[model samples]
Target: MQKNSQEKDEKLLEKRFAELSRTAFQRDIITYTDFLNLNEQNILHTLPKDTLYTRVVSFGGYELAERQMAAFIPDALYLRWGKSSDPLDYTEYPFSAVRIAPLNRKFAEELTHRDYLGAILNLGIERCKTGDILTDREGAVVFLHRDMAGLVMDELTRVRHTSVKAELLSAGLIDYSPEYEEVRGTVASVRLDTLLALGFSSSRSRLTGLIEGGKVYVNGRLITSNGYQPEEGDVISVRGMGKFRYQETGGKTRKNRISVVLRRYV
Candidate 1:
C-alpha cells in the first residue's frame, strides 16, 4: 500500500515537472515549484534531460539548504539575453528568508528545528511552502515561498513561551552554514546503518526499522539498505530524527575497526 501511494505521488510530481517545463517553454518565462524536500528533489533530479524543454535550476536561498525551489528557464530568455547572460544570476529568486528570534535571549527557551516547524504548521501553513530551517539557540532562519512570508511574519507572534519577532530578509545573496557538534566513534564498517548508529548514538537494531520504513535519505536519495556504504562527506537526513554529515573516515583501531567522525547538526 505504501509503495502504491509512493508511485501515485511520483506520477503527480512527474506531471508537475512536465507542466512547469511546458509553461516555461511556451510562455517564455521562468516557472517555479513550491519548496520540495530531499526525496521530492531527488525525483526532480532523476527526470531525463531529453524530456525537458527548458533548463532547470534549484535554490533554497542558502548554500546548504535541504529543501529547495526549482526554476524552469525557457530557451527564449537565453536567446534574448545573448550568450553573455547567466540565468542563475537573474534579477529575482522565487523564495524568501525570514529570521525569527526571541525578544529576550536570556529568558527565552532554546527552541529547536522541530519547534519552529511545529509552530508554523500549527498556523495552518502547508509544509510545501516551507524550506530548510536553520536553528540555533540565538534564533532561526526559515525559508518560505515568497507569497507566504508576509502571512507568517504577521501571524507568528510566539514560539513556545517566548515572544518572538519574524522579519523577512533580502535572501539568495546570503549564505548560511548551520553549526554542529563533532561526533567521533568507532564502527566495524562505513555501512549506512553503522554511520547512522554512530551519528545518532542509537542501536543499529532500532534504526533498521527507520531505514526499511523509507524514512532515511542520503544526498537526497532514499536509502533502505543497511549495508549501503556512505562515502565521506555525505549528508544524511532521517525523517523525524534529524540531519548529520560524515566528516571523516579514518583511524583504524587495533581491532581493525574504522574510527569515524561525524558532524551532528544541532
Candidate 2:
C-alpha cells in the first residue's frame, strides 16, 4: 500500500510539473511552488537534468531562515519579469512583505508565529499560498506571493485582541535579522527521539510516542522509527511541533555518549 501510494503521488507531481512547465513556456512568466519540503525538494532536484525547466528553476525566500517555503521559477523569464520598466532584481526576490504594526505599540502583546499565521489563515488564505511569517518583538514581516500582497494588506486588520494595520513593505523596510537562536547542545545519540526531545524540551517517552505515531519527518520523509539515526545537516520537521536541523556530531562524552549540535527554529 505504501509503495502504491508513493507511486501515485509521484505521478501526480509529475503531472503538476508538466502543467506548470507548459504554463510558463506559453505565458513566458515565472511560476512558484504552492508548498514544498525536503521530500518534494528531493523529487524536484532529481528531475531530469535535461528538461528545459530543470536548469531554469530557482528557489529563494526574501529572508534567511529555517525551512523557508521555497519557490521554483524559470531563470530567463524571471530576469525579464518586473513590476515596472526596470527589470526585477534577483536579490529583491519575487516575495512581498506585509508588515503588521499594532495600533498601540505599548499595549500590543508580542505575537507568536502561530498567532500571525492563524490571523492570516482566518482571512481565508490557504497556508500553501503564503511563505513564512517572520515575527519580532515589535511586529512581524510576512513573506507572501506578490499577487496576494494587496489582498492581505487590505483584509488583515487585527490579530487576537490587538488591532493592527497592515502595509506592503518595500525591500528597504525589511529587517533581515536572524529569526532563531543557535542552540548548541549535545545529545546521547543521533536517534530521532533523543534529538527531538532535546530540541523540543519534551520527555523521551513523549517523543517516542510522537515518532511512532508518524508525526516525525527527516528530510521531508515520514519517519516512524524512534531509533532511526539521522546524519548531520538533516532537516527534521515535527508536525504541530516545529522544525530543527541536526547540525553535526561534535564529539563523544566522558560517558561514551555521542555529542551533537542542533538548530531549533523558534
Candidate 3:
C-alpha cells in the first residue's frame, strides 16, 4: 500500500515538474516552488535531464538549509527561475521588502515570525508569492513578489491587534543577511540522533522520537533513521527546533566521542 501511494505521489510530482518547465518556457517572469518537501526536493534533483527545467533556477533564503523551509522557518528558501544569466538581477527577480512598523512602542505587541506571516497571508496572498518574514524588536521586514508590494503597502494596516504601517524598501537597499550562532559540542557518534541531540541540547531519546516521526530532514531528504550518519556540510533540519549545518569534526575526544561544530540559524 505504501509503495502504491509512493508511486502515485511520484507521478504527481513529475506532472508538477512538467508544469513548472512549461510555465518557465512560456512566461518570461520568474517562478517559485510550491512548498516542496524534502522527498520532493530529492526527486527534483534526481529528475532526468530531459525532464528538468532548462532555464536557470536559483535557490536561496535569508539562511542556508539543506531541507529548505517552504515559507515560515528560519531557513526558508525562495526558488527563482528566469532566463537571465545573472541570478542576482533584481529587475527580473522582482522582489520587494516591506518594513512593517507598529504605531506605538508601549502599546505595541511583540510580533513574531508567525504574526507577520499570518498578517501577510491574511491579505489573500499565496504563500509561494512571498518569501521570508523577519521579525525584530521594533517591527518586521517581509519579502514578497513585487507585483503584490503595492497591495501590501496600501492594505496591510494592522498586524493582529497592533496597528502598523507598511513601507516599501528599495530593492537595492534590502539586506538578506541571516543570523546564526556557532555551537561546539561532543557526540558519542555522528549518527543523526547524536548530532541532533548535541546541537539542540536535547536527549537522544527525544531526537529518536522526532526522527522516527519523520520530522527530521537532512540534505533535502527526509531522514527517518536515527542511526544515519551525517557527513560534513550536511544541513540538518528539525521541525520546530530550527536548522543547523554540520561542520567538520574536530577530532575525537579522550573518551572517543567526536567533537563537532554546528552553526544554528538564529
Candidate 4:
C-alpha cells in the first residue's frame, strides 16, 4: 500500500521535472520548484543524463542547508557567460530568509525547529513550499519561497506563546551550522548498524530493523545493509529518529575495539 503510493509520487515528480524543463526551454526562461527533500533530490538526480530542455541546479537560500529548491535553467540563461564552468555564477535562486525574532527576549521561550515549523504549518502553508528552518538562541530563519514570504512575516506572529517578529533577509547571505552534542563510544566495528547503535544508544537488533526497513540514509543515499560501513564525516539521517555525523577520531581501544565519535543533533 505505502510502497505503491511512493511509486506513484515518484512518477508524478518525474513528470513534473520533465514539464518544468520543457516549459523553461520553450519559454527560454528559468523554471523553479518548491523546496525538495534529499529523497526527492535523489529522484531528480536519477533522471536521464542528457536533457535538451534545461540544466538543473539547486539552492536553499543559504549555505549549509538541507532542504532546497530546484531551478531548471534554459540554454539562454545557462550559457549567458559563454561556456562558463560554474553553475553558481549564472543562476540566481528564487529563495530568501525570514528572520523570526522574538518580540521580547526576556519572555521568549527556547524555541525549536519543530516549534517554528509547527507555527508555519498552522498558517495553512504546505511543508513543500518552505525550505529548512534554522533555529537558534535569538530565533529561527525560515528559508521560504519569495511568493509567500510576506504571508509568513505577517501572520506567523506567535510561536508557543512567544510573540515573534519576522523580517525578510537578503538571499544567500545567511550562514548556518546545525547544533549537535559530541558523543563518544567504542564500537566493535564501523559498520552501519554499529554506528547507528552508538549514536542512538539502541540495541543493534532493533537498529538492524531500521536499516533493513529503508529508514537509514548516509549523506542522502539510502543504506540497507547492516554490515555497510560509513566513512568519516558522513552525515546519517534516520527517519523518525534524528541526524548524526560519524567520525573515527581515535585508534583501537585498550580492549582492541574501535573508538568512534558520533555528533548527535541537539
Candidate 5:
C-alpha cells in the first residue's frame, strides 16, 4: 500500500511538471522576497540534483532577447530583471523576467562609466562580495548568487534611510512597523548588574562576570561596564546568547521593583 502511494505521488508530481512546461512562460518583474518564496515552494522541490541554474542581469536592449531565450529553455536557467513597464516593481516570478532597480536617469544620460555597481551604490544598495556581475546597456550591475540573494536582501532591509522610496525597495520581506511594545516600570531604571540580579540573568554575579569578560556589545559596540544603565533604543548583544533592545523604563513598584520591556533579536 505504501509503495503504491509513493508511486502515485511521484506520478502526480510529474504530471504537474509537464503541465507547467506546456504553459507559455514569459519574463516578468518580481520582488526578491517573492522570488525566494516561490523557490522554496515550487522551484527548489522540482529542481533535480544535477540541474544547473544560471542568473543574468542586463541593463540594455537585449531584454526581449533574454526573455525569449528563457521561455524556450525554461529548464536550463532562471532570469531576473526589472519590470520595463512599471520600472519600480522588481518582479522575479515566472522564471523568465525579473527586474531590479534601474539606473538613475541622470546617470544614464551622462553614460560616462556604465556599470550596475554605481547605480546600486547610488541607491545605497549593498550586495555580498561573492555575488555575480552583469552588464547590459544600462551600466554596472550586481547579480546575487541564487543561494545568498535572500540573505543579502534581508540584511539590506535593516538600513535606515531618508528616501522613503529607496527604503521601501530595500525592505523586501521585513516588516517596518514597530511590532514590539515597551515594557514600563522602574526595573528599567536600575543598572545592568542590578537588573540582572532581579532575574534578568542566571545570577547577579554571572551578569557581572559577562561584563568583565568583555562578552557584550551595545548598539554594535562592545560594552564592559556592569554599571552601564541601558535605556530605550539601546541594543545589547551578548556572545553565545542572543541580543535584545531595551524598550522602556516603567514606573517603580511598591516594593521598589521596576518594569521593563526587552525586544529580542535572534
Candidate 6:
C-alpha cells in the first residue's frame, strides 16, 4: 500500500511540472515579484533549472535588483534603459518584464515597442507606458503582457500623423547651435591607487605585480613600476582592464583636491 501511494504522488508531481513548463513557454511576461512569491511558496522549487530568465528594469531599478538575483543565479540577464540623445528627457520608469525562449535569437527585433506595450495592457497591468519594449541580447523582441492586443492595433494606426509632425520639428532644430563649444577636460595625474578605488579587479599590489610582470603598458611601452605616475598626455593600458588616456587636469577644487579626466578607450 505504501509503495503504491508513493508512486501515485510521483505521477501527480510530474503532471504538475509538465503543466507549468507548458504555461511558461506560452507566456511572454513574468514579474520578478511574482516569481519570488511563487518560489517562497514552494511552487517553483521543482521547476527545471534549465529555464532561462530575462529581466528588464529601468536604469535605477536594475541597480536595485541585479545584485540580489546575480548572487544566486549568475545566468539571469538584466536589461536597463540606455542613455538617450536628449539630456533633459527622461526614460520611462518602473522597469518592464519579458520572457525569453531558449532557442530564440534576435530577441528584441522580433517584437516592437507597440507589441510589447500591447501585451502589458492586455494583462490588465496599469501604470505602464505604451511605448516601452523589451529586447534580448540578440535583439529579439517580446511584449510585456499578452492582454493589450487591441490597444496595440489602434496605436499602429496613428503613426503616419505623428511621424510627419516629428520630422518637421527635427528639421527646424538641425541648424541650432550653442554659443560656445564645451571644453574637453583632461586627466592631470592619476595615483597608482586610483584604479583600485575605481573598482578595478586588481589590488594596488596586484596592479604593481602586473606592471612588474610586464603585463601592464602605458601607451605602447610596458610599465615596470606599479607606482609609475601617469601624466596628462600619457595613456595607461592594463592587460584586462582596457586603456585610459589622461586628459587635461582641471586644477584643485575649493577643497584643494585634484580633478582629473580619464578618457576610456573602447
Clashing pairs in 2: none
TM per candidate comes to 0.82, 0.70, 0.76, 0.84, 0.34, 0.28
lDDT of 3 by residue, 112-201 (tens): 889888988999998766766777887987777778889999999998899999998876665656677989989888899999988898
Best by TM-score: 4
**Which parts of model 3 have CA positions greater than 4 angstroms off?**
1-13, 22-43, 46-50, 53-56, 60-86, 89-91
Error of 1 at 258 (Å): 2.9
Deviation of model 6 at 68, angstroms:
42
lDDT of 1 by residue, 195-218 (tens): 899989999999999999889999
* Cα distance off (Å), candidate 4, residue 37: 2.0
- Writing each residue's lDDT as its tens digit, candidate 2 over 1-266 gives 99899889987886676667656666766555655554565565566765435223333354333334434445564555542322235433456778888989988987898898898889888776676677777788887767777888888888998999898877666657554556666677678889998888889998899888767878766778988999988878887888888888877878878777788877
Please estimate how well model 2 matches the true structure, expressed as its whole-model Cα lDDT: 0.70
**What is the Å distance of residue 24 in model 4 from its true position?**
4.2
What root-mean-square deviation over C-alphas does model 4 reach? Answer: 3.1
Q: How many clashes (backbone atoms < 3 Å, residues ≥3 apart in a chain or on different chains) does model 1 have? A: 0
| lDDT score of residue 125 within candidate 6 | 57
Where does candidate 6 stray beyond 4 Å?
Answer: 1-189, 192-203
Ranking by lDDT: 1, 4, 3, 2, 5, 6
| Candidate no. 3 TM-score | 0.76
lDDT of 5 by residue, 177-222 (tens): 2233333334535676654444244676788897777676564445
The superposed Cα distance between candidate 4 and the true structure at residue 29, in angstroms, equals 4.3
Off by over 4 Å in 2: 1-14, 22-29, 37-93, 172-175, 179-188, 203-205, 219-229
TM-score for candidate 4: 0.84
Cα deviation in Å at residue 126, candidate 3? Answer: 2.4
Q: What does the lDDT read for residue 70 in candidate 2?
A: 35
